[model samples]
Each structure stands twice: as C-alpha cells, then as structure tokens.
Target: MSRNTESPVDVDEALTHIDSRGAKIRKEQLERTLSQLQADSELTADQRLAVERLSERLVDRLLAVPRASLQDAAQNADEETIETAMSLFE
Candidate 1:
C-alpha cells in the first residue's frame, strides 16, 4: 500500500495536531478566566493588580508546558489555579 502525502497517515503528525488543538483550547480557557477576574466589580485596586500580574504569570507558565501531554499540563494548571485562589486569602 502506497502512502499518500496529501492525506497524512502519520501517527506522530496526528498526535501532534491533537496536542496542538488541546493547548489552544486550554489557552482560550485561561484567557476567559482572566477576563472574568478582570471584569469582576468587587476587587480593590491592589487585588486587581495582583490578579492581572498573576494572569500574566499564568500565561507565561502555560506557554512553557510541553505540548505532548496536555492533560498533565492542565492538571498542573489546576494546581496553579488553586495556589492563586489560596493566595487571595494570604
């Protein structure tokens, strides 16, 4: 069976594409969460500044996660979220 270059049957390519899609989705979700935090009415100036800084840090950290295992990346992201939530009280 001859392989078609126009139609990829490469397993690695398919996995790479899937992982790329998942990372895109996670990035969008993070953006939405940050937007919600920024739009909240009750936050004081310092709280808002803290959230904005944290949001930027999250974006940086998220971009650094390996693309091959997005589920694990997301789990680690959830840990960051938990840490951020806790930081609000401290």
Candidate 2:
C-alpha cells in the first residue's frame, strides 16, 4: 500500500501555509529588487522607510480579514461598491 505523507489540512492551516509560501517568494523578490535599487542609488532614506511601513500595513490588513469573507464580499459586490471598497485598500 502507498503511504500518505500529507497531514490533513485545516482551513486556517492551509491559508497560513499558502501565506508562508507567498511571503518567501515576496521576500526574495524584495531583497533582489532592493539590492538593485541600492546599487543604482534609486531610493532615498525616506522612500525606503515609507516602503517598509506600507509593506507592514499591507501584511496587517491581509491578516485582519478571513479569506472566505473577502472572497464572498468581492464576488457579491456590485461594480461601484466594489470600486469604493477597493479604494479603501489604497
């Protein structure tokens, strides 16, 4: 018989795993892009600080919402209301 290697995933655990994987990719990209920017002298201290702060805020916001609820709201929303709600993210 073939052995199952995977643990049964709970919804929250699954989401957490997905987020962890995405964060790894994002971290690598950020490191590479930031190194390039530093090499090119493209960013000021204030700009770097602003980017760090905004990235923190975005991670906080993402963690604040349940994925199912966000999906439901987005799917059910009418266009204008969705646009307004999306504006709040910006």
lDDT of each: 0.49, 0.55
Report the C-alpha lDDT of model 1 over 1-71, residue by residue, as the tens digit. Answer: 23335542333333355546555665677668667876875567787567657755765565444333444
Worst 10 residues of 2 by lDDT: 77-86
lDDT of 2 by residue, 1-90 (tens): 223365422444434554665466557766776788789988998987776666666765764564454445445543333333344433
lDDT of 2 at 61: 73
Look at candidate 2 and give me any clashing residue pairs.
none
Clash pairs, model 1 backbone:
none
**Candidate 2 wrong stretches, greater than 4 Å:** 1-8, 53-66, 69-90
